[model samples]
Target: MSTWLLPESLADILPAEARRIEELRRSLLDLYRTYGFELVAPPLIEYLDSLLSGTGGDLNLRTCKLVDQLSGRTVGVRADMTPQVSRIDAHLLNRAGVTRLCYCGSVLHARPAGLLSDRELLQIGAEIFGHAGFEADIEIIELALASVRRAGVAQARLDLNHPGVPRAIVDSDAALAGASEEVYDLLSTKDVPGLRALQARYPGLRPETTEALTALASLYGGTETIARARRVLPALPALHRALDDLQALVAALPGHEFSVDLADMGSGYGYHSGVVFSIYAQGWHDALVRGGRYDGVGKAFGRARPATGFSLDLRKLSGGLPPAGKAQAIRAPWGADADLVAALRRLRDEGEIVIQMLPGQPQRLDEFTVDRELVLDDGTWKVRAI
Candidate 1:
């Protein structure tokens, strides 16, 4: 057995990486605030039932569960933040009108057998509750696209889809009733062979149903792909409406690139009652951002609210973003005097990163490789760049 005690699929975020992640998060959160999204933080742990109510299919199965020591009741580490935010809006905020909320935190999930998964993920997202209209959807999409640009994700594409198409097809074909989970998985991954096998197994399915499923299996690419898909599955009303909504979104966000994938592009949460999307960057294998409409999730917690939003993985975005600044050393030996401490605080408050000196360290701050040094000389403070 290995002597190391680290949990499977989970790792620590060291200082350099952590700092970059936080800086990106701050930029995104500030952008959210400028767009009128207020910040809110929910507890990291919640009762298992409340947490599970916010997810569906594979997500519910991946949650990490445990017994709360004090309450003696089962609790779960949140697999995502959307549900907790829903609970807050419905139960606490109880605002009569629309409310915009944003959050940044870590969510936990267990690695499933035969699947690639990360146990710990840092998410930053916003939710717009109590609004239901194509305008709202367009605004959310634009905001998500804008945030990705602000985060330095060059050449990002938003792949849009509607669960309604798949849901409608499945409802018309009895064989698809209990098969949504498996079919959706395959569609999202573009697993054509698997989809063909599924089609063969359910041979009694109608031609239109099969055609829609097959179209989804092959549906992925740029704007041209969406036009081709429209031809392949011509009779789908739900698909048509979804496409129209997406077209409106694209028009609203002129100059930004996007595409529509008819496939079940993976649902955001148990509450996502409408359009869903995943964002892809040039170098990343998976989406850097994912979100959609969760029209009824708030109602499950006790109110009827129509809302939508997207969450970005800060760490993932860092991987795609260009390096910000060169690594600079931090000064030390901040002196034992109160005035010296005040000087250090001023630098820190001014947004400069400061490192305090350990005992018996070098007295001359210039001995280090820092970009700048804050020092006290004759009861006055001086800052000099190296």
Candidate 2:
């Protein structure tokens, strides 16, 4: 293997793609600011326990751990920034009333999350803390939709779910006391046979319970899916509340595409207590954004608050986006003339990218295209388009 070869699922973003990513980052962060979300930058690494605390087993598996040489305690690179931002809200700021926060940075995963995903991801997201209403969920979801639209997706789909739907049913049944993971797996995969077999393990379980669980796997579509769910599912209070929440979102957000999948909440839905969602586009197989309401995400930091947010994989979102318009630069000959130097500085200060030709340098096509040039035409230095 070559010494310069990168590890599996890790690679560099060359100039063209890097420019697009940077432009999109600036645009999205500015959007967040307009909504009053203050930007925050958390450390790239922190103590292992705090990083993994309250995030559940999936986050632990993805985190890359190492020992701190100075203190000998274990530390881990962040695989996700949401938890760290939550800590800032609860411990650092500790402010009363609602707090809106946004962040963008690189996170390292022990392994790639998907076949097409990189181990190192550029994650950007916004969170709303201290507000528990569906209004918070709507605001975050709208921001997510607006983000992808700005990135060049013509039409987007929002898949909504509530982990509490399954949790409500599972918690009330004594037979499923220790088999929560098994049931979640079966439902998420839509494995009817496995669900039936699990139900058979407890011979005295009611037939209605088994039927309801099996039906959830196929409960998906547009607004009609929500109606079908309400009619088919059992009448538990928790389940009713979950369905009502979905209904409220649909009512509030009109003209947006939506689908409901009770069985497929999300990767971290086991730990996420309320509404969960993922955004999809035409060509992408995986979600471009994933987030939901995880009310107590800050409990480990000592101040629990209602928090909801969504994160976009910058690499994933940048895939089909149009390239940013390159600035028209004036290529100048390498010289120390006072007038030329002053003009060059003035052009740079006015937001133009001026490429200075170095002595003995050969013009390369990959470097840049000369749209204009500075020359002493008729004894006056002026910019002329070629």
Best by lDDT: 2
lDDT of 1 at 380: 85
lDDT of 2 at 164: 82
Query: Candidate 1 on 1-386: residue-level lDDT in tens?
Result: 67666877777776556778888888889999998999999889899888877567676776788999999999988878998888899999999888999999998777632344457888899989988876677778878888888877787888887777666666767877678778778877788778778767887767677667777777766767656766776566776776666666666766767777767556464457787778888977677788898887876688868889899778767766665454555474646788778878787788776777778765443323477766666768777676
TM-score of each: 0.86, 0.92
TM-score of 2: 0.92
RMSD of each: 3.4, 2.2
Tens digits of lDDT, candidate 2, 1-386: 89999999998998778878888899999999999999999999999988987876668888999999999999999999988999999999999999999999999999887688789989999999999998999999999998998888877888998888888888777778777877888888899898888766987666777888898888877778888988998888999898888888889888877888889856672458888999988878788899999999899999999999999889878875655455556799989999899989988898877888899988664535679998988866788898
Off by over 4 Å in 2: 197-210, 322-327, 365-367
TM accuracy, model 1: 0.86
